[model samples]
Target chain A: MRVLGVDPGLTRCGLGVVDGAPGRPLRMAAVGVVRTAADDGVGARLVAIERGIEAWLDEHRPEAVAVERVFSQHNVRTVMGTAQASAVAILCASRRGLPVHLHTPSEVKAAVTGSGRADKAQVGAMVTRLLRLDAPPKPADAADALALAICHIWRGTATGRLQQAVAAHAHPRG
Target chain B: MRVLGVDPGLTRCGLGVVDGAPGRPLRMAAVGVVRTAADDGVGARLVAIERGIEAWLDEHRPEAVAVERVFSQHNVRTVMGTAQASAVAILCASRRGLPVHLHTPSEVKAAVTGSGRADKAQVGAMVTRLLRLDAPPKPADAADALALAICHIWRGTATGRLQQAVAAHAHPRG
Candidate 1:
């Protein structure tokens, strides 16, 4: 199965795609971003995002999608913005008829590293090493997205039954 | 000043623009929707949204834009999808140098119906009567968008002194 992972943001969206098969290593398919100017209105910015997602979907036909869930933040304004970005990722996945899996920040961090409290840099370093990439992905968003994909690959595997069980329990109804 | 109100959704975004100057009665410059198919990916949907917003902005250069702020919902999946649509609205407004205002559902309800617990029909009825429109805005989303704009106009005016005072107190540092 091909899995696409996304980290959504108002200014930029990080995307990564990987092919996963039983007993085979997850192969990198694509990695990139969709961006819009900070000055655009909500309507216009959405257009840019939708278009970016459509193009990416067309290019790489992923069988499944995983997106980072929106975590609660202290700032209401930022939270609202992040929520909107989260919606875009979900919308994109659903529209394509691909089952979407949402991972919390802590879960992604734990999967990338050994600790749930791992920082972005630590997660990035781990992702680079695991994916056998020459260098860490550029822009924190992309690295995070790649990490999300890696997390899913590991969690979706038979060896990851413990983690998958916990994740499934967390999403009782989703 | 002309202000545009938007209610963003995964498949459709409701929009309404009103010219609210001192002497001029509120004029409905335009009201419509920007739509995208569920089958389309994020990028394609965003393009359609962007084009729609651009057309609206180009036709009616509203000075300010108002959008409804989405709060947490029980359904994580639904909230995630809606968030993307909201981001599109916010980004589009920001890009055009429009001073964006966000209105909570209760705030808009209260502004229109003198009560925060008003139903959609009640809010729609009041909006139609307040604006002296021939009928309630066709779709529920349209009325909601108009209500959002009205809430901003009502809250941003001299008559909204109480609200302004409350806002100031809420954010004393600002």
Candidate 2:
């Protein structure tokens, strides 16, 4: 399956496309970032992101899209931006009738590195080795995006329990 | 000027439309909520919100849009959903090149009532009075959405200072 993974952020949204099956060798189709000026209004930045994501979707035409699930981190403000950016990516994919899936950071790390607690460098190294690239993708965010796609490819479809877990993460009453 | 106010949430997204200029009394164009099932995935929920907001835009043709600014509340999960839902609203409005503005909870309360710390009942009472409605809008979310539209009308365009405040709220380094 061809999958597009998006590591969403207001300032720099990472985009990566990958072609692979569960047991087949993976190929990197495209990888990049959608950046917005920090000084721009949230609305304007979101519009730019939408345009960028739409452009990538038009170009790659991936069968499925994977987005990094955002979590509440130490930085509350940054988390909000991440959530908003992820929303834009999800909106673009779902609007196109494409299947959208979200994988948590640890899930991606475990898929790539065999350890849920793997650090950035470890995940980056695994992604490079698995993709057979000259070097790891730049800006860490790009590598993370590829890892998300890879993770999604390995996991295949989300099960009912996984969907419930997602709901529980986003909804207090879930 | 007509304004569409969006009080964004995952479970129940409140949408309120108002028509008025600075000096004239405001008219209630429409008021409703776009309800989504909690069991649905976030992507599907976001798509539903985008469709609902787009339908409102098509039916009301508001000149501008106002969305309630999401803040870091005690419930982290709920906050993420709010930010995502609000982003969908902002995306829909800005994609159409409509002027989009963000109003904080206090700002909306202050615009409709005398103080920024006004509670829900107080704001609802003032909205009913300002809109000359026989009764206040049901559901606090709907009432708050109307208050947001009223706030944007009263505050006019987001000044340079206000935009900066918005940036500061959303971005960690801003």
Candidate 3:
């Protein structure tokens, strides 16, 4: 399955696409950041971010989109912007009928580094290793985005399998 | 000038349109709420809000849009939704080239009732009095929306005049 992951922020929104599924090697399709001027009005900044996300969707054509779920408990000032940016990402993908999933920061960290409390350097190192890239993605945000996609793919596949198993047990084989 | 005020929330987004100027009576063009089911995902709710705001813009054709500025310091859990909803409102209006202004809750209350800390009922009563309505708009959010519009009109007009005056002084008309 192909998935686009978004590490949402008002100043620099990270975007990464990955193609992978259970027992398959992951491949990085693209990685980039969508930036908006801090001096711009909030509305104009949001519009710019929207356009950027739209361009990514048109180019990558991912089957599903995963966004980092923002917690209000984060930085009191920055959390609002993070939530707003994530909303834009989710809206863009879901409006196109693509499945949208939200993963917490801890979930992404644990999925790749086996530790929810892993530092940025650790997460970046693992993303580089998993994607087989010579170097980590330039910005930490981009690496986080890749990790989000990885988490979604792994978790979603396992959840799907678990559901199938439950269904089979309930009905028995025909 | 005609202005649309949006009191944004995840479940209940209040909308109000008012027509007025600095020295004239205010008229209530319209008032309503856009509601989303509690069970719907955040992205879906945001899309619904965008559509609702678009319809209001199409019908009212307000020259400007005024939205309540969300503060992250507010209720932790609810503030994120409010910020996201406000983003949708701002995006919809600004995309169409309408001037979008954000007024703080205190600013709206002060404009309507001459007090920054005015209670909701006080603000509602003033909205009813200013718009010459028989009753205050139902749902405090709706009244708060009208207050936002009223604040935008009064404050915006004054700001424009101040800027014009400064320009006139600098240029010195013959």
Candidate 4:
């Protein structure tokens, strides 16, 4: 399945698209960052991010969208901006009727590097080897986005199937 | 000026609209809550909120949109949900090219009542008195929404004008 992963942030949002499924070799379709000036107004920054995500969606048309779930941070303003950007990504996917998955940072790390405590270097190294790229994606955020897409393909798909099975078992005879 | 106030939440989002300026008497144009089932998916809940806010904007065509700034809470999940909903409200207003204002809880309270530490009952009472309504708006959320509207009319307008003046002063050619 084609999946688009978004590492949501107001200053620099990471966008990556990967085509793969469970037990299949992953391929990178695209990777980039949506950036907004720090000096821009909040509304304008959000609009820029929205337009960037929409452009990516239109070009790639991924089957599913994966977003990094916002977690508590020492800086409330930072977390709020991340959450707002994350919401924009989810909103775009939902508007297009595509299923959106939210994976925590630890979850993505564990899925990509087999260690929940893996650092940025470990994630970048693992992503490079998995995608068979000569070099890791530029900027840590882009690599993180790729890791999120890989995680969704490796873990989110399985979890989704399991939930479907449970629901079917509860109401059979379809 | 007409202002739309939004108290963003997952289950029940409060919406209120008011018409007036800083010194003139304010009139309540609309007040209500947009609710979604707790069992609903996050995407569905967000879409419901987006539609509700859009409908209100379309009907009232408010001159500005004011949202309650989300504050950090002990519950991470609750805060994330509030931030997400708040983003949707901001997105709707931004898309329509309307100016969006965010007011802190204390700021809203101070604008409505004499004290920033005013409790819910105090804020509700002040809202009732300001709108000249026979009774306070039902549900604490709705009253809070009305208070937000009233506060924006009383404070945001002046702040906006001051910003404009500063901008004009910096660039006199325009």
Best by DockQ: 4
How do the residues A54-151 of candidate 1 rate in per-residue lDDT, one tens digit apiece? 78888998777788878654355565566777666666667566777778888889987989999888988988887789898889899898888877
lDDT of 4 by residue, B79-138 (tens): 888999999999999988999999999999999998999999999999999999999998
Candidate order (DockQ) = 4, 3, 2, 1
Candidate 1 global TM-score? 0.61
Which docking band does candidate 1 fall into? Answer: acceptable
List DockQ, one per candidate, in order.
0.24, 0.56, 0.68, 0.71
Recovered native contacts, candidate 2: 0.69
> lDDT score of model 2?
0.91
Better of 1 and 2 by TM-score: 2
Residues A1-174, model 2: lDDT tens digits? 899999999999999999998778999999999999999889899999999999999999999999998887548789889999999999999989899988999899999999999999999999999899999999888999999999998885546457778889899685
* Cα lDDT tens digits for candidate 2, B61-142: 9999999888875487898899999999999999899989888898898888979999899999999999999998988889
Of the two candidates 2 and 3, the one with more favorable lDDT, higher being better, is 3
* Residue ranges of candidate 3 with Cα displaced over 4 Å: A163-174, B166-174
Per-residue lDDT tens digits for candidate 4, residues A135-163, read 99988889999999999999988998999
**Winner on lDDT (1 vs 3):** 3
Ranking by lDDT: 3, 4, 2, 1
Model 3, A1-174: lDDT tens digits are: 999999999999999999999789999999999999999988888999999999999999999999998888778768878988888888898788788988989999999999999999999999999999999997999999999999999987788799899999999973
C-alpha positional error of residue B118 in candidate 1 after TM-score superposition, expressed in Å = 1.4
| Every candidate's lDDT | 0.77, 0.91, 0.92, 0.92
By lDDT, the better pick of 1 and 2 is 2
Per-residue lDDT of B48-110 in model 3, one digit per residue for the tens?
A: 998999999999999999999888877877998898899889889988989999899999988
